[model samples]
Target: MMRVLAIGDIHGGLKALVQLLNKLEIKDGDTLIFMGDYVDGWSESAQVIQFLIELSEKINCIFIKGNHDVWCEEWLRDGSVDMTWYIHGGKETMESYSGFSKEDKQKHLAFFENLKMYHLDNKNRLFLHAGFTSMHGVEKEVFQTTLYFDRTLWEMALTMDKSIERDSELFPKRLTHYHEIYIGHTPTTNFGVEKPMNATNVWNVDTGAAFKGKLTAMDVETKSFWQSDNLPCLYPNEKGRNKD
Candidate 1:
C-alpha cells in the first residue's frame, strides 16, 4: 500500500536529510509532503534545493512554502536580502550557491516559486508551513502572511482542553476546519519534545533540524516516524541556526 509521509523543516541539513531518506527506504509508490524552510541554516542550502529538485523527478512529492523560502526566493530573483534572514542562516544559504550559474539559480528560483502555500489532501487533512487564522477556514484567511507565519493557531491548539469535542462551541473554530492539520515552522524541540507532536488534531513535525535537533518524517497514516541523527552530530563544525 502507498503511504503518505510528512517531512519537516530542513534548514539546509542535506546530510541529515539523506540519512533520513535512507532510513525510510523510500519507494516509488509513496508520496512525500515536505513542509518547508528548505534553505537557510546549514552549509548545504543550495545543494539541498538541487537535491530536492532531482528527488521530485523520481518520487511523488509536494512542497510547501515557508517564511525562509520566501526570503531565499526573493534573493534568487533580485539579489534582495532580508537582514533578519541573513542573521538566521541566509548568509550560509547564499554561500552555498557560490559557483552556480545564473540558469541553475533560475531553476531553483522556479522551484521555490511553484511551492504551495498549503495543501489539503482528499481526506481533509491540511498541510502548511505554519498556521492560518480565519475562523471559517484557510479559504477565508485574511492575511496571506499568516499562512506561513502565524503561531496563534498552534498555540491555541496546544492550550486547548482535550475534553472539548469538535461539536462544542467552546472548541476553537480554526481547529474545526480540517480533519487533521500537519505543520512545520515551530519546532517541537522548543517545547522540550524531540519528536513529532500532536495536540488536538494538529500535528507539529518540525523537530528542529535548524537547531540542536533531528530532521523528521512521519507517516501520516500510522503516525510512525523516522528521524535522522542529531543535526549537530551531522555537522559538528557548524552551528546551524543555534549560533549566537
Candidate 2:
C-alpha cells in the first residue's frame, strides 16, 4: 500500500529535515504533504528548498503555504521585504539566497508561487498550515489569512469535554465534517510534546523545528512517525531567529 505522510514546518532546518526524511524511508509510490513555512527561521532556507525540489522528482508532493512562506515568496518575487518576517526569521531566509544565481532563485520562487493553501486528501482529511475559520467553501476565498493564522479551532478542541457526546450547539460542525484535519503552524512543542500532538480530530505536526524542537513527519495510514534531533542541536553554532 502507498504511504501518505504529512510533514510540518521546516523552518529552514535542512539538516533536521534531511535526517527526518531518512528515517521516514520515503518511497516513489508514497504521497507526501508538506505543511509549509519551508523558509525563514534557520540559516539554510536555500538548501531546504533545494532538497524539496529534488524530493519532488521522486514522489508526489503537496506543498501548503504558511504565513512565513508568503513573506519569503514576496521577497523572492519582487525584492519586497516585511519587517515582521525579518524580525522573526526572514533575515536568515534572505541571506540564504544571497549566493544563488537569478535562475536558481527563480526556480525556487516558482515553487513558492505554486503552493496550495489547503489540500483535501482521498481519505476525507484536510491538510493545511494553520487553523481555519469555517468549513464553508467561501471562507477560503474571503478570509484566506485565517487559513494560515487562526488558532480558535485548536483552542476549542482543547477545551471540549471529550467524555461528553459532541453537542452541535457546542462542537463545531465544520470540524467534525472531516475525518481528520492536519495542521502545522502551532508547534506541538508548545503543548510540551516533541512529536505530533493530537487534539480532537486535529493533529498539530509542527514540533517547533523553527525553534528548538525537531522537524516531524507522520504516516497517515499507519500513524507511525519520524523526527530529527532537536533542531538547535542540528545547527549548534547558529542562532535561529530569537533563539538566545
Candidate 3:
C-alpha cells in the first residue's frame, strides 16, 4: 500500500532531513508532503533546496510555501531583503548560497515560485504551511499571507473544548471544512512537546528543526512518525534559530 507522509518544516537542517528520510526507508509508492520553511536557520539552506529539487526527480513530493520561503523567493527574484527576515535566520540562508552561480539561483527561485500555498487531497485532508482564516475554507481566504502566517486556526483548535461536537455552533467553522488539516510553522516544541502534536483535527508537524528540536515526518494514515536527532546535535558548531 502507498504511504503518504507529511513532513514538517526543515528550516535548512538538511542533515536532519536526510537522516529522517533514511530512517523512513522511503519506497516507490510513498508520497512526501513537505510543510515548508525549507530555508533559513542553519548553514545548509541553499543545499537543502538543491537536494529537494533533485529528490523530486526520483520521488513524489509536494511542496508548500511558507513565510520564510516568501522572503527567500523575493530576495531571489530581486535583490530585496526583508530586514526582519535577515535577523531571523535569513542571513544564514543568504550565506549558504555564497558560491552558487546566478543560473543556479534562478533554478531555486523557480522551485520556490512553483510551490503551492495549500493542497487538498482526495481524502478531504488539507495540507498547508500554516493556518487559514475563512470559515468557508482555504479557497475563500481573502488574505494570501494568512494562509502561511496565521496561527489562529491552530490556536482555536488547541483551546477549543473537546466535548464540543462538529455540529455545535460553538465549534469553529473554519475547521469543519476538512476531514483533517496538517500544518507547520509554529514549533510544537514551544508547547513543550517534541513530537507531532494533534489539537482537535489539526496536526502540527513542525517539531522545531530550526531550533533545539528535531526534524519530523509522519505517516498521515497511521500517525506513525520518525525523527532525526536534535538539530543542535547535528550542527553543534551552529546556533540555528536558537540565537533568536
Candidate 4:
C-alpha cells in the first residue's frame, strides 16, 4: 500500500529530473526512492544533489549508492584525485560547487557515505542500486562493492529455473523473495543481452540518462513509468577521459 516513486539514474540531469518530479506532484504517504548516480554526466551535479537533499526533508526519500557515487566519494576524500573523476562528468559536478566552503564539501561527503545499499519494504519490495550476486549470498552477505558493481547476479537471474517456486518459502531468490525488485545500473540493453529469458521478477529503471538514452522513473505501486528525452552532454565523451 506504500506508494513509492522510484527514479532511475539521474546522471546530473537536474532540469529533466526536476520536471519529472514536478509532473509526479509527490504527496504525503508517497516515498521517493533514488537509485543513485546523482552526480556526474550532466552539468548540474551539485545543484541536483542540493535539490534532492532538500526534497528529502519533505518526503520519504531513500538513496542507494551507484558506481558514479563511489567515484565522487573518492574524489571528495582526496582533492588530488579530481582528474580520475573528471572524465566521467565529475568535473562538471565539481564545477557546480566550485565556490562552496570547506564545510559544504564535508557535508556532501557525509551524505554520499550515508547512502544505503538497499531498502526492503515489509518483505514485499526491494530497492537496490545494482543487482546482487550468488557469491554475495543474495540478500544475506551484501557488500558495498557488490551493490555497485555486481553484474554476474544479473546474468544468473536470467537463467533462474522457472520450475522452482519464484516466491518459495525456502530458497528465496532475491527477486522471488520480494513481490518485485527495483534496480538501477546494467543498462536495459545489457539486461536484454544478458537476460533473454524475460525474467519478470526484477524491474530495471536505469534508462541510460547519461548516454544516448532517457531518464526514467517508475511508480512502484501503480507500475507506471515516466521518462525524459536524452539531454545534450556538457563535454564530449572522448575529451572527458579520466586519465588520472
**Model 4 stretches with alpha carbons more than 4 Å out:** 80-84, 135-139, 159-174, 189-198, 233-244
Give the residue spans of candidate 1 off by over 4 A: none
Model 3's alpha-carbon lDDT is 0.96
Candidate 3 per-residue lDDT over residues 1-244, each given as its tens digit: 7999999999999999999999999999999999999999989999999999999999999999999999999999998999999999999999999999999999999999999999999999999999999999999999999999999998988998999998899888889999999999999999999999998899999999999999999999999999999999999999999964
Worst lDDT run of 10 residues, candidate 1, spans 235-244
Rank by lDDT, highest first. 3, 1, 2, 4
Pairs with backbone N, CA or C atoms under 3 Å apart (clashes), candidate 2: none
Q: Candidate 4 lDDT, tens digit per residue, 1-244?
A: 5578889888888877977887777778888899988988777777787788888888999999898898888877776556656777877778878877788778788889899888888757878888776432446754668887776655666666767675565444455556777788766744442111125577778777766556777887777877765544433442222232
Predicted candidate 2, C-alpha RMSD = 1.6
Q: What's the lDDT for residue 230 in model 2? A: 90
Error of 1 at 133 (Å): 0.7
TM-score of 3: 0.99
Write candidate 2's Cα lDDT for 1-244 as tens digits: 8899999999999999889888878777888999989988889999999889998988899999999989988988999989999889988898898789999999999999999999987788889888877655324436888888888777877777777555556667767667888999987778788989887888888989998888989998778888899988989888785456
Tens digits of per-residue lDDT for model 1, 1-244: 7999999999999999999999999987999999999999999999999999999999999999999999999999999999999999999999999999999999999999999999999999999999998889998998888999999988999999899999999998888989999999999999999999999999999999999999999999999999999999999999999955
Decide which is better by TM-score, 3 or 4: 3
Question: Mind sharing the TM-score for model 1?
Answer: 0.99
Residue 56 CA displacement from its true place in model 2, Å: 0.5
